[model samples]
Target: MYIPLFDIDGTLLKGGGGNQAHKNGGSYAFRTVYGLDDKACWDNIITDGKIDKQIILEVVEKNGISHKKALAKLDEAIDATTSYYLEHSNEGTCIAADGAIELLEELQKQNVPLGLLTGNIEAIGIDKLSKAGLAKYFEFGAFGNLALRRVDLIEIARERAIKLVGLQMTTSKFMIIGDSTLDVKCAKDGNIPVIGVSTAKSSSQELAEAGADLVVESLLQKDDIVKFILD
Candidate 1:
């Protein structure tokens, strides 16, 4: 059976302004942990496809904090950011992408294993999925806190999937479903097939150009998506 590892933010969930909550949490962490009060410092950094620690380090370094200092405070900052997001973002703030749940249901019905490979910290990712009612669909996840680069999560996810399913699945037996070129890049780096869904920031053209094996406008293309995965 094939295992599809989905990206959380854009692939499974969208809108609800929960992202603002994450930004607010990051700013809060900066002020509380690093003593940096510049919200713009946190806001200006591009966070796409990067892990939480990478984002935090970038923000702190941009504000003149040394790399060592940022590393020392990284865990605390991540905790603060997660705490703030969990406290602020509730079910109302997480909206499942169009046809996301249906797609999961169809895949699940086919006995395909579902997992998460996302740049979100574990807690925040779970919170968002729980809010969107997507948490139940995923059996395991490789979260952002586990690595500094998105590509690294691919191997971790594979190992975990092997353990969870008790099967020695090769990279070819796995597929990545996400909405960003970063996701495509991660898959390419790990030698995994990737399907790009243009339901968020990155467009289909960009994802195709990034070398995604398949690109779809959205998960709403359920038949095409399912066929790609099973094939």
Candidate 2:
């Protein structure tokens, strides 16, 4: 069986990140935890594909906060962001990407080793999936808090999946599902193929240009995606 590690925001749900509210909430967490509040500091913190610890470290150095102090408050910031996302999601969140539920459901039917490799921190990632009622599909995941680079998380997920499902996993048999060039590069850097979904801001052609192995307009495509996973 193939193991498919998924990305949450753009790949699974619409408008999951890169919005005003989430950006503000993340920035707020940094300020509250480290008292590191500067527009430039916040901007450096949550750029494309950055992890939580990386964000904290940069914010600390750029803003002159002690590294030890930032490390000490990292957990507080993490919890604060979790609270922020959970509370804000009530208005309207987790609009499952077109075909996301369908695709995940079919994958589950085949007993594919489904796991997450996402930039969302663990707390927020779990909450997003749980609130969307999609948590059951994911058996395990590599979240942003675990590693700074996305490639690192791919390896982490691969190791976990091996133990989680007893699969003799290989890169050729692994696939990363996501929506950005960063996602494509993450998998490519790990010597794995990426299945790109353009339901997010990136277009199909853009994903293809990024060297995505397959660029589908949405997961709902009737084309046998399982073939991508299995054949």
Candidate 3:
């Protein structure tokens, strides 16, 4: 019952954020409203380097929609993107993190149960993983747009994992892998161990500060990562 929940962006997927097209396009709605497209703004305000209420407000303001309305729009956008990408895969638009596939293969071989818990909406999340051929690795997942807060998705993921595995899994059986402080907080809130990877916005030191159980520089270090997680 060792359920390892992985975050796609920065954890298993690297560079430019997974499903960049979706975020980039949607972010324009915000940038157009506030002229805040700079990296510093996105890194500091939108993602908060950590999950908090300020980040939530930024998301709403950026989108030029009420939080409730934004949630609805996010759902629609995800569904649309998922359908489009699934239909038009193999164009090389979707990329997987280095060593991500190999690590997943190894985990699968060991019969370690796997699932996805991401801040990405369903359409965007499924499209990225499906395109990268990593979708099959997960038994189920929780999407960001499904709820207002990342912690809310944790329960959804927990329920899905239980249903998929047909058994109850304790927090000790859970491990969340991601690159951001947001990922760290979500896992901590869920009362699970977190494996942080510095493949996205956050660094190893930052992840450690955010309370990551283990922070690796890259998933490319397959032997070390495997040993660290499986040890």
Candidate 4:
């Protein structure tokens, strides 16, 4: 059976106050851990398509903290970030992207094993998905806290999927569906097929250039997407 691993932020959910909630959470963490008061600290950082830990390290390092000390405080910062996001994220603002729920439902109906592969830490990702009514579709996932790179996360997810199915599935049996160039590159690097959804940052052309096997304008093209997966 083929397994599809979906990206959460832009690919599944959209236009939620989730982004603000994350920034607020990150700011709170920085304040609590590093004494940084600037709430807009992440304003200049390129956060899209990157994992939470990588973002944290970049912010702390740029603020003059040594790598060793930052690593030591990593768990502390992550906890603070997760706590704040959980407290502040508004469920009402969490909107499912166009056709996201429908496509997921169809895939579920077809008995396609679904999983999440995202840069979001587990807590925040689950919170957002729950808010968007998407958590039920995924039983397990490979989250950002597990790795700094998306490619590594793919490997981790593949291992977990194998354990879940109790089968040694080849990497080709896995597919990544996401909206960023990083998603395409990571899937390419791992030698897994990737479907790029142009629902967030990257355009279809950019995703294709990044080596995506398929580039979709949105999940609205459910028939085509479903056929691709089944084939």
Candidate 5:
């Protein structure tokens, strides 16, 4: 079976309608857990499709939150961010993107191996999907909470898919589907093909420039996508 690794936030659900609520929640986590309120600290950083700890570390550095102290409070800060994220998703700010449910259902019918490859901490990622009632579509995933880099997370996804789904083939047989250039880059790193969906901030043109094998405006055509991937 071909393996398809899906991204959660932008690819499946539109979290906070493109980062407003999510960023607000992260800022809250930084202040409450790390006391980072310097607006300048967050100005230069881009959090979308980023690892949970990486974002916190950037905030720590930017806000002058003693690296040592930040390290000490890493777990707590991550917890706070994830908790806030869960709260927002629970509050109905995040909803399934258009055609996302239909696409997932169609993929499931093909009996393709489905798993999540997301930057969200495993709990937060799964929680977002769970809240949207889409969690049942994924059997396993490699989450940001487990790795600090999306590239590393991709490898983790491969290993887990192998273990859980009997994914018995070279990594090239796998496909990474996501909405950001980061996803495209990591899939390239693994020598895996990436299918870009424009459900997130990246326009189809942007994702194409990033070297996505296929760029779709949205996951609206199930047969066409499934056919191309399977072929």
Candidate 6:
């Protein structure tokens, strides 16, 4: 049988701050709009309730820096923040939830083919798995940068797995295991079962509400994660 597709943040790697860590904070936004350095811009953003368009225009007009530059800097800052969190969390070490890697290993030994489907960009996702020495476990996978929505990229993963591994697995054989409501929605949109692991922000009940076929609070117990897939 084809193995399951897993999500990275909040699913496999613990403490790798998810979307909240990725959002452009008000301070960061203000910095970009005002062309100010990190400290001064952040100080105003934190104290001010709203960012003024006048301030943005004032900075842009005065600095004579291209608007594109500011925009690019904003994107860069977001990536930098994400990278900082990834580095601090020691994502390179894996540090997955209890039995997370072991469960994948068990499935691997059983000849099940596995893949990854993460919301993280390809480079960041690959580095995390590689550092954890878990990259070899997945011969195929998809990353978030492909599309804005997870469902759009879930299909990408299926197609890649079929082509790269020459496996003719269908939606029925495909499964997604993750820790959030988005995972359930993404899998359902792709017409597959989504196994929700409640080890992160999203609880089992929330996942159920979002349409998870099966929910596991923790996969540390023997055969728990494996049986969910095969059963």
**Each prediction's TM-score against the native?**
0.94, 0.84, 0.76, 0.94, 0.87, 0.70
Task: Tell me which of candidates 2 and 4 scores higher on TM-score.
Answer: 4
Instruction: For candidate 3, give the lDDT.
Output: 0.68
Reference-based lDDT, each prediction? 0.86, 0.75, 0.68, 0.86, 0.78, 0.65
**Which regions in candidate 2 have their CA more than 4 angstroms from the true location?**
16-21, 38-46, 56-76, 222-224
Which digits, one per residue and each the tens of the lDDT, describe model 4 over residues 5-57? 99998999995568788878888989899887556566578987888999999
lDDT of 6 by residue, 1-231 (tens): 446888876777775433333323323544544445644443322111111232332344345556666544544544554455454444124556677778888887778888888766666567666666677788988775455457776678878988999877766788888887877888888888888888876887898999998888876753867877777
Task: Please write out the lDDT profile of model 1 over residues 96-147, one tens digit for every residue.
Answer: 9999999999999998889899988899889889878899998888998888
Q: What is the alpha-carbon lDDT of model 5 when measured against the actual structure? A: 0.78
Candidate 5 per-residue C-alpha lDDT over 73-191 given as tens digits, one digit per residue, 9 for 90 to 100: 88887788777766675444558888888988888888876888887777777766776878998877898777767888877887887798777667677788899988899889888
Task: Point out the worst 10-residue segment of candidate 4 by lDDT.
Answer: 35-44
In angstroms, the error of model 1 at 127 is 1.0
Ranked by TM-score, the better of candidates 3 and 6 is 3
- lDDT by residue for model 3 (29-127), tens: 334433445343455445523322334346655645576654444444444444544444444366688889998898888777778877665666777
Q: Compared with the true structure, what per-residue lDDT tens digits does model 2 show for residues 1-231?
A: 468888888777777442444556677787777676546676544455556667666777668877777777777777786677667756546666778788888887887878999888887777767767778898888888887577899888877777887766776677888888888988889888888888765788988998998888887873556778876
Error of 3 at 94 (Å): 1.9
Model 1, position 93, has a per-residue lDDT of 78
Q: For each predicted model, how many residue pairs clash, with residues at least 3 apart or on different chains?
A: 0, 0, 1, 0, 0, 0
CA lDDT, candidate 6, residue 212: 91
Candidate 5 vs 6: which has more lDDT: 5
